[model samples]
Target: MEFKNGKITKGFAFLDTYELTVLMKAKKTSKAMKNTMEETQGYLGMWVTEDGYIRHELLPNNRYDEDRGKRESAYQGRYKVTGNHIEYIDDTGFTADGDFVDEKTLHHGGYIFHKKLE
Candidate 1:
């Protein structure tokens, strides 16, 4: 995505929810992994600044019938621009009061959504 003059132009990329969880568990730095989880959730709402890193928030799921009251109020994570694709990482797991369901069923896995902020 392109951000110029404080506006997003190219939109955001939503990562697969199950893929995200696995990625978080593979981080070499415990702190980086934590930051990744937090960034994912923060991106769902606005942006978050932790450890001097700036992260943009991604769009949330709009499947009203399925996500009506299940959507989170915020997102965490920072997007790293790599060529044409954006890499995402959850800074830290869900925050306090964050609505993250147990991954027992297929629908309970976490999902990432993205949109351009132009």
Candidate 2:
């Protein structure tokens, strides 16, 4: 897959039987990293998961208030590759202590990524 000018082009022959390998290689490239940073910063963050169940923390951020003096809030979630979309769950109340402090279910859609199978 190749992303250029805000478009993602798929069907690279080299990626047919090496999708994950190629994707990881692209991910490690400077251009991909820069794009990843830009896209992720444009949103709260991004996450990637395997087997549609396991979760991986990609980026994390905290929201703070200075005027009303409210406690800091966190934005955290996971992504699962489901069919053609990377289903996401966000605002999961992820804490630095590895615990979810919020009482909410903490499951909401985040970002979507297409899964490339080898």
Candidate 3:
């Protein structure tokens, strides 16, 4: 923020040309971040059960089985999502990655997860 003669001239607004200089500069960075979403219900529950229920669980936090519910071992890993790319880090420090093939399809671990009912 800045103070000028009888005006509340601030960081976002510039009195030099009465322009929003700061917001314009940050727009590019904001646009990049906007392309990524975190833990949306659709993405969080990608896996479906045999009974046609979407397993709304967080990845990297638990090892879950469609038949056996959640177990104490396997596939517990943290994940990072940016744009269409996903990175995974498991409990054993193993790292993997995948990309979104489409809005309803994810290509991960050599498997194609589809949003279709199975």
Candidate 4:
């Protein structure tokens, strides 16, 4: 019985060590993701269609405000950009995504938006 108890204790220790290692790895991965997002800041700015009907403002805080057909802030959302691809989760729970075709162009929801020059 004493031998069995010793094995159980060793097993618990192994599990604890494994959990700690996993947590450390997770923290490292999170930092890497944050850095990647920060590097994407160059893409931040206003993007609008040629006709000036739809506008999307990509803010530095990782949130977006969209205007449509003179409607101010038609939609508001949080966004994540990964390697020229973007995912959005709006305040109303609607989700959408887009791709950056280039430094000045974004293609989303069948609409092509150009970066509005300041």
Which window of 10 residues has the lowest lDDT sum in candidate 1? 100-109
Question: Across residues 1-118, which tens digit of lDDT does each residue of candidate 2 receive?
Answer: 7888879865465436578878878778956544432243332232222333423333333331111113222344454332222334555543222211122112223322222222
Model 1 residue 72 lDDT? Answer: 48
Expressed as tens digits, the lDDT of each residue in 59-94 for candidate 3 is 444332222245333456577777678777766788
**lDDT tens digits by residue: candidate 4, 16-42:** 888899999999999765554236565
Q: How many residue pairs clash in each candidate?
A: 28, 0, 2, 0
lDDT value, residue 8 of candidate 2: 88
Cα deviation in Å at residue 35, candidate 4?
14
TM-score of 3: 0.45
Per-residue lDDT tens digits of candidate 1, residues 1-118? Answer: 8999998878878989998888777764675534433354432343222321323344454111112233543344444332223344444533222222211111112333332234
Would you estimate the TM-scores of all the predictions? 0.22, 0.18, 0.45, 0.66
Candidates arranged by lDDT, highest first: 4, 3, 1, 2
lDDT accuracy of residue 89 in candidate 2: 51
Which residue ranges in model 4 land beyond 4 Å of their true spot?
A: 1-40
Candidate 1: segments with Cα more than 4 A from true spot: 1-69, 93-118
Candidate ranking (TM-score, best to worst):
4, 3, 1, 2
lDDT of 2 at 61: 39
Name the TM-score of candidate 4: 0.66
Candidate closer to the true structure by TM-score (higher is better), 2 or 3? 3
Greater-lDDT candidate between 3 and 4: 4
TM match of model 1 to true structure: 0.22
* lDDT accuracy of residue 85 in candidate 1: 31
